[model samples]
Target: MFKSLLISALFVLSSQVIAATATNIAESAEQVSPLLPGLAVPNIELKDQYGKTVSLAERFKEKTTVLIVYRGGWCPYCSKQLANVQKIEKELADLGAQIIAVSPDSPEKLAESKITSPNYQLLSDDSLLLAQKLGLAFYLDDKTAKIYRNKLGVNFVSLEGEVKVALPVPAVFVIDTNGLVNFQYANPNYKVRLTEDLLLAAVKSVSEQ
Candidate 1:
């Protein structure tokens, strides 16, 4: 009888551990799931290029927002994307939309980006908090992190001094004045990006709606 009771207790403890592990995995997966259309944008505060605190939700309240999330200033692809977006900045303004780009680079680095445009806003997400809330954050494996640090000299240290190798999937989200995402595009492949035509179309659709 004593042996049976001990076995039963151990089984219950093991089951609880398994359940906890599953729950953790689920949460992690959810964090990486891209935010979809019709979802309310997360109202996270981030620092603008000048290091001023800015609320994303407040920006949405001002006008339709064309939000872009990129890897960092060090990434050439991100530079190209920013340049492409700059080409359409005038048209976006004509449609009454505001462009806001977020990246893991520090505020100082944002100013140094090759594709900096006066027409749009650049915000820093060095802590990756905003990306995580938007379901666009992903951790770099140890091997990749080592390559990025040693070979590329890309440090993942935040402004607050935390070191973590994480990056946001490049994404574009069009949020209306109501703070609702009318369209979103996210791709895990760093090389691929949404075309300017598609982005303009998405912004136009949101403006029309």
Candidate 2:
């Protein structure tokens, strides 16, 4: 366990070095990335935990949608954020909003995240197609990648592999039915995620339109 914790810390430090110029993202469970805000939200088609095809515009037809993208279930912070948002889902819906969470975790791993986050829709960005298209993907260097695998046992290979490519740093954006982003929450630090209260405010504000 100590080794794992150390590995996780080292992993975070590595991510920080890479995201230094843009945003300072970190590790998870309850960790939130500090990647700064971006300009737009692109159309993306990922999968649900059930391996069913999902498209943003289609699911959110004629309604407001919130896109909350994360690294994967590896972090504890993501779980907390997901659970919190789900708890206040009613508050969000009251403002005429729908929400979807995205991650690069394959359906199998995403299914594990879904087991913990059963309420919200978990979209799988297995190929990270949208992240790459949106310029949100970042490749992990060797030293850092080694820590995630040799130390933390992150298990990305079962889904993809360590030598794969970049993963999407955690990010959140609220998009209106028109498919334009109204608000965004991004950070490179994995420890910091947007609070549910703040997200609720964004929903309320946008719904007034």
Q: Candidate 1 on 21-112: residue-level lDDT in tens?
A: 33111122225687788899878999987899999989999999999999887888998998899989999999999899999888888877
Q: TM-score of model 1 relative to the true fold?
A: 0.79
Task: Candidate 1: list runs displaced more than 4 Å.
Answer: 1-31, 114-118, 151-164
Q: Write the per-residue lDDT of candidate 2 for residues 3-42, one digit (tens) a residue.
A: 9999999999877755543422223222432323334455
> What's model 1's lDDT at 163?
51
Instruction: Write down the lDDT that model 2 would get.
Output: 0.68
Give the candidate number with the greatest lDDT.
1
For each candidate in turn, the TM-score is: 0.79, 0.71
Top TM-score model: 1
